[model samples]
Target: MTSTLFRALLAVLVVGLLVGQSDAWRRRRRRRRCPNPTDALSGAQTAWDATFMFECPGAQVIRRIRSAHCNTVEDRVWRFECGTVPGVSRFDEAFWSAWLNEYNGVMNFQCPFNAIVTGFRSEHRGNDRKWKLKCSKVNGMTTFNHAQSNYANEFDLPGDYTVPSGYYLRGMHSFHDGRRGDRRYQYQICLIDLP
Candidate 1:
């Protein structure tokens, strides 16, 4: 009967649609190194600012933070919220002291830039988002020539920034001179986009 044929055709169509969807999913799973479903949901979240540094091809986006350390979510949020460089934290008291002695006391400056300076920041965080590390006191060094950059940031120390885990350092980049002066003191950080 035509009625039976109609039902049969409908079932076949449904099956074909399901098969196509499954194939697409399979293809996606195979393509990415991290087979985790969460990873699939969160694609690359990198973003960049148009005008920070002229040449930072490595990170696709880079911006400077003379005082604000956007490496941690806490610092980033403060910078984002105030739209200025965040003041040094209680945790950074030691660094502030050392820095003051190391260099001419860096004024409690503001976060400088707000966009990624480069397109290539490494993925330091895993799927977790709650890393409870703190910024430490750095001594005896006015300029740290870490892989971060040649320019020294008033806020950037080194190692284990207290950014929450799983959150990832997605698109940091704060500008310097929270006080406002010549842009020469400006520093930049280009972040890899977060999910």
Candidate 2:
């Protein structure tokens, strides 16, 4: 009888151990499925353009962007790196306003799927000017966004412009000034609300 009781206790202990291990496995699986923000940016791909439109391929969100004037030409160039986020299968169709004739105005674009503006690219030539915005669906986010454009000259110090309390930087455009032999900047920022 003692031997039988020992076997039964051993069985109960083994079952408990198995159940605890299964719970741990499930927790690990859940963590693997839900990606952290940094994890979403780990597998990034870079796309650059001088005069053409730059778009992140297929549902990926832009994670970083860099813009500067081209060294050989009197034009601006931009590079954007993008990545995918787990559990976000697809993004809303990107939308942009018609290319305006002037470059220094407020350009606004909205997403139908309630996505937020993640990045932007602007084209500024003599007579042609336009902006393209990249959108991504993030959790605890809202729609109905607006962008404010600020020039470097607007601030006392260059590159010292501060983002508004609830806004974030979305795009940067640089123009080469032949007279100054330097580059000037215009920054586009979008509003965001935190929950």
Candidate 3:
């Protein structure tokens, strides 16, 4: 009886270990299947003043692009990307907003309701740049709504910027701010809840 009990106990232990390993393998497999952010392409390029970089948040992919030329010296361009998260399906329909301006300080634009900015239209007026954003909705995600600039002064200069993990790039704004023809850039990042 003692020997039989020991064998049964060992069998139970082996089964438990197998189950745990199976669960771990599934989790790893799912992670491997999850997508990675693609290469950052020129969302917008111009002969205006400066060059800057914008990238999608973790595991997100580029989905669209928008560009406009307000004048010879005031043209702007934007690239957009989207990806699947734990509670979100594919980005469905996309919409555009009317031109918006934020004067000399900041031109902050957030997608209304549960939408995210996928593309944009920018107009450089006298001393301000007005923006019209292309917004899109993620099918299953609603835990995030608003996007805000990561820097107070729109990062002041042009360079590379990436959205942190659990967040995505919603919009990008750049304008000729100083007298040296330098450009100031603003990146709007939106945070999402991950499982």
Best by TM-score: 3
**lDDT for each residue of candidate 3 in 17-129, tens digit (9 for 90 to 100):** 99999999999877644121121124444323234334344434434343333222333333444555545444565667766555454555666656665554555445345
Q: Each prediction's Cα lDDT score?
A: 0.26, 0.49, 0.51
Which scores better on TM-score, 1 or 2? 2
**What's the ranking of the predictions by lDDT, best on top?**
3, 2, 1
- Give candidate 3 misplaced runs (Cα > 4 Å): 1-44, 47-89, 102-106, 125-128, 145-149, 152-156, 171-183, 193-195
Candidate with the greatest lDDT versus the true structure: 3
Give the per-residue lDDT of model 2 (tens digit) for 18-85: 99999999988776452332333332232222345566677665554543332223333344556554
User: What is the descending TM-score order?
Assistant: 3, 2, 1
Give one digit per residue, the lDDT tens place, for model 1 in 125-152: 2111111111122122121211222334
Model 2 global lDDT (CA atoms, 0 to 1): 0.49
lDDT of 3: 0.51
Q: What is the lDDT of residue 13 in candidate 1?
A: 99
Report clashes for each candidate as comma-separated counts: 40, 0, 3
Alpha-carbon RMSD to native, per candidate: 17.7, 20.4, 21.8
Q: For candidate 1, give the lDDT of residue 111.
A: 21
